[model samples]
Target: MKTALENVHDWNFEINYNTVTAVVEFSIHFVSTEQYPLLEYLLTNGTKSLLLLPDDWKLYEEHLSDNEYRYYLGGCIRAFDIDTLIEILSSNFPCIYSRLKKNSIDALLHHDQQAIHGPARLIGEPDRYRFLNCILNAKKQLKSS
Candidate 1:
C-alpha cells in the first residue's frame, strides 16, 4: 500500500454539488502537477507543492476576517514547503476548529458545493477529515452536517 503522502501525490479531483439531487459527488484521478497551476506555482515558488482544494482559492480571498485571511496565506506558504495538505475553506484544521468549536465534516462538504454558486473542487481530499472539519467551522461555514 502507498504511504499517505505517496497516495496524495497522484491525485486530481472533481466535485459536483447536485443542485437538483441535493447531494454531492467527488472523484479523484492520478493527475500530476502539470494539471494544476497552483501546484505548478508552489513547485516553482521554492516549495515542492501544496495540496489544497480548488474552493480554497476562493476562501483565501473570502476569509471571514482579514486577520484569518492574512494568517492563512502566510501559514500556507510556509506549510507548502513542507508538503502539507490544506483544505482552507473546509475549516478543517484542528487548531482552527478547536478555537471555534464548529465540528462537522459533512458541513464542510456543503460549503464546498455552495462555493462560487454551486460547485467547487478541492485540490484533493484532506489527509484527515477531522482537520478539514475544523477549518470549515473556523471559516464560518454554516452547513449543519
Candidate 2:
C-alpha cells in the first residue's frame, strides 16, 4: 500500500508499527498544493466509517488555516493480537475498534433518536457524530476480536 501510494507523484505515505502496543499508524502526505481538495475529501469521507474511531479530524478542523492547508492524513489501529492485525491489513478495507468518548457516544444516541423520529436539524453535527460513532465502534470491536 505504501508503494502504491508513493507511486503517485503528488502523494507519499509511511506506515509505522508499535510492537509493544500492537498498533499500526498509516500516514499520508500530499506534496502538491492542488491536491488539497482530494486530501479534504479523503479525510471527510474515508474517515466516515462505523468501524474506525475518530482521530484528529476535530483538531485538524480547528487548527487549519486558509493560507496553510494541512496535507497529511493518518489513522491508527490497535489489534488484539498480531494475527488480527495481519488479518485487518490483508482485508480490502481495514478497520479498528475502540470505545467512544462520552460526548461522542451521546451524540450517536441523539442521532439515532432523531433518525427514527425526524430528520436531524443540525447542519453538520449529526454527520460528525455518525462518523465518529462508526470509527469508535469499529475500533472497539477490533480490540475485542
Candidate 3:
C-alpha cells in the first residue's frame, strides 16, 4: 500500500499567489515523515526541523509580498497534505476539514460563487453526494466515526 506521504504527494493546492512553491515543498517535508507510522509520526518524526534551502526559504519569506505570505503561512489551511490522513489518527495536528470549510465559505462570499459551486456540481453522480456530505459534515462525522 502507498503511504500517506506518498498519497499526499499527489495532492496539490492552487492558491492565487506564490503558495504553489511553499505548498509543494511543505508536502515534500511531510512525505518525509512517513517512516514514523500513523499516530507516532507527528510526535516522533522530526518534521518541524525539516530544512529548506535558501531558495526554498525565499518562497516562504514574509517580506516578498502581501497576499503570498498570508495564505502560504499554513496557519490552518485545508489543502491536502500528509496531515489529512494523519489527522484521522492524531488529534495533535490541525484538522484539514475545518480549514477547508473556512476556505469554501471565504470563497463563496468573496470569490466567484460559480467558480466554487460549479465544479462541485461537476462531480460524478455516484460520488457527488458523498463528496458534498463530507464537506458539510466533516466535524460531526469525524467525531461520530
Candidate 4:
C-alpha cells in the first residue's frame, strides 16, 4: 500500500494578498485524504513547526471555532500569514524556497500559480519534483534506521 505521502501527486501553496489590508494570506492544497496522518505530522512535527508560536496558536483560536480549529490541527485546511508560509517552505523544502525567494512573495506565488500543470491543475512539476524528492529522501532515512 502506498503511504499518504506517496499518494500525493501534487500540491500547491496559495497566496492571497489584500492590497487594502496589506495582509498576505496563505494556505496549502494537496491531493491527500483528510484522514492522512502525514498532514498532522507535517503541521505538528515537521521542521517548520507552524503551531509552536503562541501568537499563531492564539490566531487559530480566535479565528476558528472549535470544529474549525480541529480541522486545522488535523491539517484538512489552514489559513495563515505569508511569514508562516515562508518559514514552512524554507525549513521543510529549502530547494523550492531557494527558487521562490528570487522575487517578492506576491510575485513569486503568482508566477508559480501560472506555472502549474494544466492537466492536473497542480503546482509546477519542477517545484513538485523537488518537494517530493526531499520528502521521499526523508522517508528513506527514517526507514533505514
Candidate 5:
C-alpha cells in the first residue's frame, strides 16, 4: 500500500520544549495504498514513540474531532518502555526529561496528558490511562499554574 505521507520529508517544530512544550502536528494528504500504518516520532527525551496510524494520515480526518491526535501521542510515548524513556530524559534530546526532578516528571506527565486525554475524551477507550498516571499526583501544580 502507498503511504499518505509518502513523499513528505521530515518536519521541524518552530517552538522547542522549555517550560512548556510545543507539539508539531504531522499530516499526510491522501493515499491509495496501505503504506503507512505506523508513525515513528522521537521525543525530547531520547525515547522513540511509534504509533500505528489507522490507514493513513488522512484517516485522522474521520476521527479528528475526538482528540485522536493527542491519544496517538500518548500511545506513541507508551511504545517506549520506562527504561527507554528514562534514558531519553537523561540524554540531550530536546524533549528529554528527568523523572527524578518534580518539574521534569511533571512536564513529562503533562505532555502525555495533553496528547492522551484530549483524544481519549474524543475517541473514547483503552488509551485513556496509558502513562497518564505518571503525573496524576502533580496535576494540581501543573494545571493550575
Candidate 6:
C-alpha cells in the first residue's frame, strides 16, 4: 500500500533513559524522485512539539482530521513499538499513558499544530512492531536490576 508518506527515508528513534527524552528523527521524500533535498524532521516527547512541513507545503488545522494525513503522519509515530511506547509514556505521563495504547501516538504529538489539509496516502504494514520485544525485555531487565 502506498501511503501518503510512501517515500520514507531513514528514521531513527533515540531514547534517553536518564533524561526521559525520546527523539524520533527521520527524513522523507515529499517530492517524488527528488534527490539531495529531503524533508527532515525531529520529534521529541514533549508538549511544545513540532511538525516541520516542507517549504512548499502549507500548515492548517483541518489537516489534523485527515485520515490519510493522520495515517501517514500518525503512522510515523505509531510505527514505533506500541508496548514500549506505552511503558515510555507511562513513566512520563503516568495518568494518561494508557490512552497511548488505545489511541494514535501521533495524536499525542502533532494534533493541533497545523490547520491546512494536505494529501496523505495509505502506508503498508511491514513489521510495525520492530523493536517491541527488545525494548520491553530491556525494560524488564532494568526493572529487575
TM-score of each: 0.20, 0.32, 0.18, 0.28, 0.23, 0.26
lDDT of 6 by residue, 20-135 (tens): 32322222322222121222332223442233332334211122222322112111233244343544333332211001111344543543333112233212222223333344
Worst 10 residues of 6 by lDDT: 93-102
Query: Which runs in model 6 stand beyond 4 Å of their true positions?
Result: 1-32, 35-84, 87-126
Per-model C-alpha lDDT, please? 0.28, 0.37, 0.26, 0.33, 0.28, 0.29
State the displacement of the C-alpha of residue 113, model 1, in Å, after optimal TM-score superposition. Answer: 35
Give the range of the ten consecutive residues with the poorest summed lDDT in model 4.
68-77
Model 3: lowest-lDDT 10 consecutive positions: 36-45
How many steric clashes between backbone atoms does each model show?
17, 11, 0, 0, 13, 11
Question: Cα deviation of 23 in candidate 1 (Å)?
Answer: 0.8
Could you tell me the lDDT of residue 92 within candidate 3?
A: 28
Which digits, one per residue and each the tens of the lDDT, describe model 3 over residues 70-134? 11222222334324323332322211211112234544565443333211111133333433344
lDDT of 4 by residue, 31-124 (tens): 4332221122222114444432112332221123322221222121233433444454445332221122233456445554532211212234
- Global local distance difference test of model 3: 0.26
lDDT of 2 at 138: 53
Q: Can you write out model 1's per-residue Cα lDDT over 1-145, one digit (the tens) per residue?
A: 1211111243333333333433332333342221111221121112223332223433222233423221112113232222232333233221110011124454454444322122122333353354345433433422443
Error of 3 at 97 (Å): 11
Pairs that collide, model 4: none
Give the Cα-based TM-score of candidate 4 against the true structure: 0.28
Runs off by more than 4 Å, candidate 4: 1-4, 37-49, 52-145
Q: Which ten residues in a row have the lowest lDDT in candidate 5?
A: 116-125
Which run of 10 residues does model 1 get worst, by summed lDDT? 93-102
Question: Which number leads on lDDT?
Answer: 2
**Residue-wise C-alpha lDDT for candidate 2, range 45-64, written one tens digit per residue:** 22232232325762232123
| Candidate 5 displacement at residue 105 in angstroms | 38
